[model samples]
Target: MNKVLLIIQREYLTRVRKRSFIVMIFVVPLLIFAMGAIIALVAKDSDKLSSEQVVNVVDESNIFSDKFHDVKNIKFKPVKASLEQLQVAAKTNESLLILSIPADYDKKNVVKVFSKKKPSLLITDEIGRQMNDIAVNNSMLQHHIDPVIVKSIKSNIAVNAVELTDTGAKDANVGPNMAVGIACAILIYISLFIYGAQVMRGVIEEKTSRIIEVIISSVKPFQLMLGKIIGVGLVGLTQFGAWIILSVISTKIAGEAFNSPQGSMMGALAVLQTIPFGYILGCFLFYFLSGYLLYSALFAAVGSAVDSETETQQFMFPITLPLFFTYILSVSVLFRAPDSALAVWLSIIPFTSPVAMMVRIPFGVPGWQLALSMFMMVAGFLFTTWVAARIYRVGVLMYGKKASFKELGKWFFYKE
Candidate 1:
C-alpha cells in the first residue's frame, strides 16, 4: 500500500510538472473561441450569398410572373413564346428547370411540376405546395366563402403528452430532451477516447525508454499501472473542469452581448436546469469514471503487452466498436422510441450504458433501471481492472516479441 501511494505520487508529479500539462490546461479555451469565430464567419458569408435556383414557369393561362421575381440568386424570366424557351434556359444554365401549367389546366385538382435535378425536389415541392394553396384560397374567395373557415380547417393539430410519473425531475422540458442527452453522451465518448489513448501512449513511451524496468524494480506492476491510471485520470478531470469554467464564462459574456431573449447561452445553461440534473450528472460521473477507467486499464494492459504502438491496432477495434455502436443506436432510439425494450436493455448494459443511459435519462428512467446500470458499470470496471492488471504484470517486462490474444489469455491464468 505504501508502494502504491509512492508510485501514485511519482506518476502524478512527473506528468503535472511537464510543459504539456500547463499548455493543455489553458489552450482548450482559445481553441473553442477560434471554433466559434470560424462558425460566425461561415454563417455571415452564407447569409450574404443567395441560394441560386432557376424556374421556367410556363403559365399557359397567362396568370403571373412575366418579367420574374428579381432576387439576387434567383431570376424569373417570362416564357411568352414556347416550351422550347424553357428547355433552352434549362440547358444553358439560365434556369434550373421548367414549370409548365397548361392553359386548360383545371384549377380545382392537383398541380403538376417538372424538375430534372433530383436535388431540387424539395424546392419544387415547396413551390408547388405554395401555388396550390394560393389557387385554393383564390378560388374560395371568388365563391364568397369565408377565408376564416378555411384557415381554421388548415390549422395544425397539436397533442399534449403529460407523464403521470416524475421519473426525470431534472430533465422535465421536452425542448432540452434530445440535446441534453446527446451532449452527455458526446462528453462521455470524447472523455474516454482522449484519456484512454493518453494512457496507452504513455505506457508505450515509458516501456520503450526502459524506464518501466527501473520503476518496476522499486514498485509492483499492479501498483505502477494503478498509479498511472489514477494520475492520468486526474489530469483529464483537471482539463475537463477548466473547459467547463471557460465555457461558462464565455457563454455569459456572449449572452450579455447578444441581449436576445432566447440568448446565446441558454442551451448551455440548461444543463444546470435540466430537471433531475443530479441523475444525469450522477450518471455522467459514473459512466465517465468507470468507462474511462475500464478502457484506460485495457489500453494500459495492451500497451504493456505490446512492443509498439502499431501492435495495438489489432486489439483497439474490439474496445472501440462497442462504444461507437452504442452511440449510433442511441441516436436512432432518441426519436424512434426512447421507452422501447431495446433502449431499456441497452441503457442497463455496462458496455453501452455510458451513452445509452445518458440518452435515456432525459426521457425519464425507472429507479431500478438507473441503479442496475450503475451497478453493472461499477462491476465492469472492477472486473476489467483485475484482468488488465494480470496482463500488465507480465507484459510490462517482456519485450522484442509481440504479444497475441492467445498470450493475453495465458497471462490471465499465469501464477502470481
Candidate 2:
C-alpha cells in the first residue's frame, strides 16, 4: 500500500508539473473566447451583406392588394402587368419570383409562382400564410362574422412540468434536463479516453524501457497498476476541476465586458441561473470517476500485454466498443426515451452504466436505479482490476511476442 502510494504520488506530480499541461489550462479558454468573438463579428457583417428575396406580385383580383407582406429576407413587389410580361421579366433576375393570383382565385384558389431559380421554403411558406389569412378574412366578412374578434380569441399554451419527489416538487423542464445530461455524458466520454489512454501509455512506456523489472522488486504488479490508475485519475480530476473554475470565471468576465442590459449576454446569464448546476456537477463527478476507473483497468491490462502502442489496436477495439456504442445510443436513442427498457438495462449493465446512467441523470431517474448503477459500476471496476492485475503480473515481463485473445484468456486462469 505504501509503495502504491509512492507510485501514485510520482505519477501525479510528474504530469501536473509539466509545462504543456499548465499552458493548456489557460490557453484553451482564451482560444474559445477568440473563436466566439470571430463568429459574432462574422454574423454582424452577414446581416449587412444579406439581401431580401424580391417577389413580383400580379394581383388581378385587387382584393388581395395589402395581403402580401415583407419579412426579414423576403420582399413582395406588386406589379400592374400580365403573367406573360412578369414571367419574361423574371428571366432577368434569378432572385426575382413572380406570383400570379387569377381573377377566379376565389373559386379555384390557385396561385401560380414563376421564378428563374427555385424559391426557398421560407419564402413559399410565408406567401402561403399571408394569402390564407386574407382568404379567411374575406370569407369571414362574407358570412358577416368579425375576423378581428376571432383572432383575439386565439391563445398560446405554455406547459411547465414539475416532478413530485419525496422531499418536494422540483422544476422538470426537458430542455435543461437534456442539455445537462448530454453535457455530463460528453465529459465522461472525453475524460475516459484522454486519461485512460494516459494510464495505458504510461505503463507501456515504463515496460518498454525495462523500468517495470526494477519497480517489480519493490512492489507487486497489481499494486503498480492500481497506483498508476489512481494517480492518473486524480490528475484528470484536478485538471477538469481547474478547467471548470477557469471557464466560469472567464465566461463571467466576458459576459461583463461584452454584454449590455439589452445584449444576449444578459439573456444567457438569466438562462444559466435557471439551470440546476449543483446537481449536474455532482452527478458529473460521480460518473466521470466511475467510468474512468472501470475503463482504465482494462486499458492498463492492454498496455501490459502489448509490446508497443502499435500492438495495442487489436485489444483496444473490444475495450472501447461498448463506450462508443453506448454514447451513440445515449445521444440518438436515450434522449428520446430515457426511461425505456433498453435505457434501463444499459444503465444497469456494469460495462455501460458509467455513461448510460449519466445520460439518464438529468431526466430524473429513480433513487434505487441510481444506487444500483453506482454499485454495479464499483463492482465492475473491482472485477476488471483483478483480471488486469493477473495479466499485468505476467505480461509486464513479456517482450517481443504479440498477445492474442487465447493467451489473455489463459492468463486469467493462472495462479496468483
Candidate 3:
C-alpha cells in the first residue's frame, strides 16, 4: 500500500509539474472564450459579411410582374430579356441568378432557376415561398375568396413544459436540460479517451525505456498499474476542476462588463436556476471517474503488451467503438426519448453507461435506474482491473515480440 502511494505520488507530480500540463490548464478556457467571441462577432455582422445577390426574373405569366421584392441579401428585378440573355448575363456576373416563370407556370407550378454557381438554400427557399404565396392568393381570388381571411385563420402556439415532482410542479427548461445532458455526455466521452490514452502512453514510455524493469523489483505490476491509473485520473479531475472554476470566473467577469437589469446575465441566471446543476454535477463526477477507471485499466494492459504507440492502434479501435456508438445514440436518440427501452438498456449497460447515463441524467432519470447504473459501473471497473492486472503481470516482462489478440488471451490466462 505504501509503495502504491509512492508510485501515485511520483506519477502525479511528474505530470503536474510539466510545462505543457500547466500551459493547457490555463489555455483551454481562453480558447473557449475566444471561440465564443468569434461566433458572436460573426453572427452580429452576418449581413455585412454577405454580399447582396441580384436575381433577374423573366415572368411570362405576368401575374408576378410587380410582386417581386427585395429581401435581406437578395434583390428581385423583373426583366424583359429572354432566358438565353439572362443566362449570358449570369455567366459574367457571379452574384447574379436568373429566374424564369413560364406562361403555363400556374399549370406546372414550377419555375426554372439558373446561376453561375449553385445558389444558397436561403435565397432559393425565399423565392419559392414568395412565388407560392402569390399563386395561392391568385387562385383564392379566382374562387372569390379573401386571402386576408385565410391568413387571419393561421395560428402560432407556444408550449411551456412543466415537470411534476413529489414536492410540487415546476417549470422544465427543456432546451437547457438537453444542452446540459449532451454537454456532460460529450465531456465524459472525451475525458475517457484523453485520460485513458495518457495511462497507456505513460506505461509504454516506462516499458520502452526499461524503467519498469527497475520499478518492478520493488512493486508488483498490479500496484504499479493501479497507481498509474489513479494518478492520471486525479490529474484529469484536477484539470476539470480548474476548467470549471476558470469558466465561472470568466463568465462572472463578462456578466459584470455587460451588466443590466434586462441583460443576458439575468436571463442566463434565471435559466440556470431552473436546472438541477447540483444533481447533474454529482452524476458527472461519478461517471467520469468510474468510466476513466474502467477504460484506463484496459489501456494500461494494451500498453504493457505493445512495444510502441503505433502498436496500440490494433487494440484501441474495439475498446473505443462502444464510446462512439453511445455518444452518437445519446445525441440523436436518447435526447428525444430518454424513457425509451433502448436508452434505458444503454444507460444500464456497464460498457456504455458513462455517456448514456449522463445524457439521461438531466432529463430526470428514476432513482432505482440511476442506482443500478452506478452499481454496474463499479462492477465493470473491478472486472476490467482484475483482467488487466493478470495481463500486466506477464506482459511487462515481454520484449522484442509483436503481440496479437491470441497472444494477449494467453497472457490473460497465464498462471502466477
Candidate 4:
C-alpha cells in the first residue's frame, strides 16, 4: 500500500508538472470559447448576406388574403399579376423571384418558385415557413375552428417535471437536464480514453526501455500495474478539477462584465446561475473515477503486452467500441426516452453504465437503479484489474515478438 501510494504520488506530480499539461489546462477552454465565437460570427454574417432580399408572393386562391408576413430581412410583395405575367416580369428583372401558389394549393400544398438564377436556400426556407403558417390557418378556418382558440391551446401546454425524493420535489427541466446529462456522459467518455491510453503508453514506454525489469525487482508486477493505473487516474482527475474551476471563474467574470442594471447578465452567462453545479460535479467525479479505473486496466494490459504504441491499436478497438456505442445511443435514444427498457438495461450494464447512467441521471433515475449500476461498475473494474494483472505479470518480461490473442490467452493460464 505504501509503495502504491509512492507510485501514485510520483505519477501525479510528474504529469501535473509538465508544461504540456499546464498549457492544455488553459488552452482547451480558450479553444472552446473561440469556436463558439467563430460560429456566432459566421451565423451573423449569413444573416447579413440574406438581408433585404425581395420575395414576390402570387397567391391565386387568396389563401393568405394578403396577410403574408415578412420574416428576417425578406420582404414579401403580394403581386396581383397572373403567373405568365409574373414569369415574364421575372425574365426582365433579375432581382424579381416569383412564388406562385396555385388555386389547388390547399390540396396539393405546392408552391412553385420562379427565379432567373437558383434562389438562395435561406430565401426558399423563409418562403416555405410562411406557406406552412398560411396552410395551418386555412385548415383551421375550413374546419370552422377559431385560430385564436388553437393558438391559446398551444400556449397553455407547459411540462414541468418534478421528482419526489427524500428531500422534497426537485425541479426537472428536460432542457437543462439533458444538457447536463450529455455533458457528464461526454466527459466520462473523453477521460476514459485520454487517461486509459496514458496508462497503456506509460507501460509501453517502460517495457520498451526495459525499465520494468528494475521496477518489478522491488515491487510485484500486480502492485506496479495497480499503482500506475491509480496514479494516472489521479492525474486525470487533477486536470479535470482544474478545468472545472477555471470554467467557473471564467463564467463568473463574464457574468460580472455583462451584468445589466436589472441584475441579469447578458449573453449565455446568464444561464450559469441556474445550473446545479454541485450536483453535476459530484456525479461527474464519481463516474470519471469509475470509468477510468474500469478501462485503464485493459489499457495497462494492452500496454504491457505490446512492444510499442502502434501495436496497441488492434487491441484498443474492442475496449473502445462499447463506449462509442453508448455515446451514439445516449445522443439519439436515451435522451428522448431515458426510462425505456433498452436505456434501463444499458444504464445497468457494467460496460456501458458510466455513460448510459449519467445520461439518465438528470432525467431522474430510481435510487435502486443508481445503486445497482454503481455496484456492477465497481465489481467490473475489480475483476478487470485481476485479469489485467495476470497479463501484466507475464507480458512485462516478454521481448522481441508481437503478441496475438492466442499468446494473451496463454498468459492468463501462466502460474504466478
Which prediction has the highest TM-score against the true structure?
3
Order the candidates by TM-score, highest first — what do you get? 3, 4, 1, 2
Per-prediction TM-score to the true structure, in the order listed: 0.78, 0.75, 0.91, 0.79
- lDDT per model vs. reference: 0.77, 0.87, 0.92, 0.85
Writing each residue's lDDT as its tens digit, candidate 1 over 62-149 gives 6544523444454455556677765665565633666677766666443354455453455555566656666676688899987779
Evaluate residue 165 in candidate 4 and report its C-alpha lDDT on the 0 to 100 scale. Answer: 68
**Number of the top-ranking candidate, with lDDT as the measure:** 3
Total backbone collisions for each predicted model: 6, 0, 0, 0
Model 4 scores worst on lDDT over the 10 consecutive residues at 264-273
140-214: candidate 2 lDDT, tens digit per residue: 999999999999998999998887778899666678778778878877887899999999999999999999999
After the best TM-score superposition of candidate 4, give how far the Cα of residue 210 lies from its true spot, in angstroms: 2.6
If both were scored by lDDT, which would come out higher, candidate 1 or candidate 4? 4
lDDT of 2 at 386: 85
| Global fold similarity of model 2 (TM-score) | 0.75
RMSD of 4: 4.6
> Could you give the candidate ranking by lDDT, starting with the highest?
3, 2, 4, 1
**RMSD of each predicted structure:** 5.1, 5.4, 2.4, 4.6
> Residue 160 lDDT in model 1?
46
